[model samples]
Target: MPAAPEMPWLPAQLNALLAQQGHALLLEGPSGLGQFALAMGWAKALLCEAHALGTPLAPACGVCESCHAVQVHTHPDLLVLLPEAMQLDLGWSSADTDSASEAKRKPSQEIRVEAMRKMITFCQRTDARGRGKVVVVYPAESMNTVTANALLKTLEEPPGNSRFVLATEASHRLLPTIRSRCHSWKMAWPADAEIHAWLSAGHSTAEQVQGAMQASGGRPQNAWELLQSGFEPQAWSQLPRQLLQGQAGLLAAASPSQTIAVLQQLCHDVMAMVVGAVPRYFSQDSLKPLVAHLGAQTGETITQQLQQGGQSPRQRTLERLAQWSVDLQQAQRTSEHPFAPELMLTALLDQASQALQAKR
Candidate 1:
């Protein structure tokens, strides 16, 4: 197999993790920080025959059969547990079970108890290769109470040389027992310069790289995904003014959830601007023209008025924006529900326009 493209920030972390001793490791960090990639890297390194025979701290040799198996997702001694929806998204095939019934149901977003049961069974079995067995559970918070409890005992007392890696974007959502049974490692955030260099090495142009870095808040994985998705940085910068002008067509192709996520970022930046802070996901120039309508009060004045609970025009606008943010959160909770895409887009646009135009 060929060598995998480097993440620029994971190799050192992987080597550091390899030096540690633990039966179970919990990789926790915010979304888009490459938790899954780091977890998989650890698993591959552990199962690499060369690493097993050579230096324990060395990374997996890509030419090894074990490394190839991992690359192809056919490792006999390794198991990856992911929700059905995520499996589909990542191009991994779910286990073959009741094909007719599965075809009738939508892919699940939560790791089911059945998958946990299978993982427990996998843990009990002997390692196909002498390198030992590894079980990787990604987005570990996807395991609900029942599923989490099913694996708790095994996590507490693993059979044979079995090892486990549980990766999560939201560690707080995991049960305390699950969290306590493993050694936790926080994923590192790469600097913007590193991220920019990495993105530029790919097909992204210099301008696209800059836009993607800002759009993804300097997260490399997300910036790469944004570049791949064909969402122009110019469009993103203009989104606030477009929303204020009641333009819903810009997001017409997006799902309700995707649209809501974009709106949430916009809302977050607008709120930051209202209080005189830097915008995170969009450029200040793009947002400044739109927020200029809020009048001449400085951010300090707005903060003072808000502190005193005064009802100034900026305060009223801030209040409206807060309510809009709450509404967007509520919408996100049900954004996956089946709805007419056009109707949902129009309604969301109207809501956003009203909130952006609020000045009373």
Candidate 2:
């Protein structure tokens, strides 16, 4: 494997930091922005015994054992801490033990105090190989208050020959103390042309890829996921029909998260179409129906309403959508109720319709 060129934005800063004896980095960006991957690459470079490049401090040699280990997720010193699953152990009927061993593993939710304890213990220990260790707390915002505090102490004093990299999509969710402890690297979204090129290289349907990219709000990685997952564009194309036709059954059959996602994408396209910035995927055929559904009157009404709504009506809408996603994820993990998806989608679509019609 060869090292890719340094990303244009913060690579220089990162490169210089790695050249230093030891330093900590807090890479922050939206989910799917590739912060975790970049952090791993940085770690590989830092641990590379034979780093090589044109500059005095160049990128890591991908051929090195350290780089290979990091790439394969087998780096002995690379400790990745994530949330644990939550489930109870069944015993003799109606006899649940209260002992620590009998305690149920908490379903994977947030990074809790227990996880922080393990990280602290690991960081405090002398490395078996006497080489530097790297700790990556990904999705760092998952840390609960207690866990955040516990982790703070370790961050304040990273162990000798160890580096701590906290990566998060929600940097604002972390404590100010935590933010101040490490050097921060913020990432930018990929350009539209760049996204298109990557999608083209993958031999994706140009229209679907373009539509997915726009639907994903220009997030290239998510656009790729939508394509690979075979997300039914028709599921979304049917949205305006369902809304205008008041086909409650259609809404009821969809997942709340998927429904809201579609509605949000529709709203985005509505705005784009109004401005005549419609991407090729949404041109003519697709835009015509969507535009008619949004109609000049309704489109202007809703767009204006959205403006007064907040700094980001889309953000609020997406948050509401995520509630459904979380509920479904939980139900699947627990195998308690499988009807959650249908219920959520119906509620979301119904709410959107009501909101749209409210001005009438």
Candidate 3:
């Protein structure tokens, strides 16, 4: 998607970086912020035939021929490196792959070395258009060692006026040598107002917008996808208690990684309720019943509950929650494990509820 001129924060920051003359940029941050969109905006500005509104930091005028080519993904100078799976999911043309090998290919989850080789060759060619080239590597951590190493040489010495932007959710995974060669900028969370406006513009219900944002930990892209994926707002509100009770088969729809993430969020909120801290993921009002059900009085606050009801979580429950957190971390590390379909959701919840039970 083209950068929405209305949300100028990311583009404005990118515009400031324009004068640095950095040949490569590493846009590292958690997902949801507009890294990809901002990177494209910067690239298009570099290639645009017309500068926008006469400001040095201004974005490209969207109507020019160069801008049109980039918008249509036909820019001769733009090379995008993404996993084959991401490419297909985003509807980027797969015609770049050799036609003879198409049928035998499994959609790749990692950026393959062959694409890097093609990018290297592309860098050497004369710019088909006179304005120079842009190379975009998105979710850059998807580059396996071999694929990443292939770009190290080029990044150290980018060809001609070509510029590179590598956007990643996990920057620590990048090769240290590669990282040292580029200027790094971390993506920041967008203003809540911007997020709300973006969701509202798409005709999303308030509950859908809120539920999706909470479910996604404020990732706008994730929330947007959740809106289209038919995520039930009601299910999200009631999930904590039902999930703790091992009654939430609806949760089976989440991937293993997502399942663990939700559980972690739930665990965090429950512990937060125990200490009267605000819930981080779910709305506190929505979580009141859940907190009350966990053997806490749910008095005006956890502090009041402790004073009036003479209650504190038993030591066993605390241990169990701590252990559960550890277990979730381990699960996150091995998220690709081929867990059994029938047992995955139920088993995880069953373990959670038992851990959450009050010790007599």
Candidate 4:
């Protein structure tokens, strides 16, 4: 196969993982760590038809028929399982599946048991194209109980020349029994340097890249997505002040889940400032309100130095921001079923202002 380095699909950490041995590999980690990429890379390597060039670590010959097929996601032996919504969004469904004759409804968020059953049948069959079959279930935590249960039987036993790679952000949500059947490999985060290289490989300016990276909380994929969505560096930098000022222009445009997430990050940073821990998402200057006095009005810059050893104003502000962090966590859960958009943004802003203005 062509060199792994030449392939954009192989992250550095995933190349190392390709060398390992496991019939059923569970790639587990938080989102944006390239679990899906690693899973797909491994599958491509496993199913590559090149015998002379293939090895345990570098299995794909990028020039081979199998490699081309896998790249386009049309490899006959490969079955990719994803949530119904995700499948449709990704154009994974066949023409028949997407046909107008079919019943129309919102696609499911969870993997259905029927897909699991179909996977089982696919695995039992002889190799369709002389290469062994590969099954990939991305975000495996999307499997509901029934779907997971249906998969357990197949997972516990092996069919000839068949392999499974289940990639998930929340492995804890999977049935413990199902977990036991597969060898688990935790995905590793790429370093900041690697992330920067990946981000700047595109047409983005350095400032926009940096801003997108911080907005994504260091997730390279998320940063790339943000850049693709036309995030502005100036807007990202001014977001904390904007939220404080009750202006929800770009923030309100985000989905409820995303809006709450952004707010949660803001709350976390303020709380971090309160306790004197360096903030993760926001710079110290941006979180100055965390170091401000209670009832400090908007646009009125407070410059009183925090008392080194007394019940200082900074201490009082920290206390209130800490409470806001707790409240935001609860809010994060309910973000999936949000109130009317305008109301939700208003309430979130009000909560933030109240916390910033609280006394004691």
Please report the candidate that would top lDDT against the real structure: 1
Query: Model 1: which residue pairs collide?
Result: none
- Greater lDDT among 1 and 3 belongs to 1
Candidate 2, superposed: residue stretches over 4 Å from native: 1-22, 52-58, 84-106, 232-238, 247-255, 264-339, 358-360
RMSD of 2: 8.7
lDDT of 1 by residue, 203-313 (tens): 768999999888887777787878878858888887777776667645867888889988989889988998899999989999886688555433456677777676777
Model 1: residues >4 Å from true position, as ranges? 1-4, 52-57, 95-98, 296-310, 358-360
> 1-360, model 2: which lDDT tens digit per residue?
122233443455566656654367888888766676667667666666574433354567788777787666666777766554311211111122245764564345576676777788888887654457778777788889998998888878777778888889899999999999888877667667866777555556787777677557676666766777564566545645556556653345545555555555555554555456764333355556545544433334556666766434444444443454554454344432236665655555565555333221
Cα lDDT computed for each candidate against the true fold: 0.84, 0.62, 0.77, 0.75
lDDT for each residue of candidate 4 in 1-360, tens digit (9 for 90 to 100) = 111122243556566777677789898987776777788878888777776434445757688898898878788899999987777545576544565644375566778877888898898889877768889997899999888987887887778788899999999999999899998998777778877877777678998889888878887777887888888877766777766665664786787667778878887877776676887776677667544633353233244332333445656566767788888888887776666767877777788778766321
TM-score of 1: 0.90
Give the per-residue lDDT digits (tens) of candidate 3, residues 1-360. Answer: 422234445766776767666789999888868777778778888888886433464578899899899888899999988888788666575685647677477677788988898899989999987777899998889999998998998987778778899988889999999899989987878877778778666677887888888878888877777777777788888776566455764576787777888889888877777677888778787677666776552225668556645544444355567888888888777665536744666566676766666221
Model 2 lowest lDDT segment of ten: 86-95
Candidate 4 wrongly placed segments (more than 4 Å): 1-11, 52-57, 88-96, 99-104, 290-339, 358-360
Clashing residue pairs for model 4: 1-60, 1-61, 2-61, 2-62
C-alpha RMSD by candidate, in order: 3.8, 8.7, 5.7, 5.7
Q: TM-scores of the models, in the given order?
A: 0.90, 0.68, 0.80, 0.82
Angstrom error of the Cα, residue 229, model 1: value is 1.2
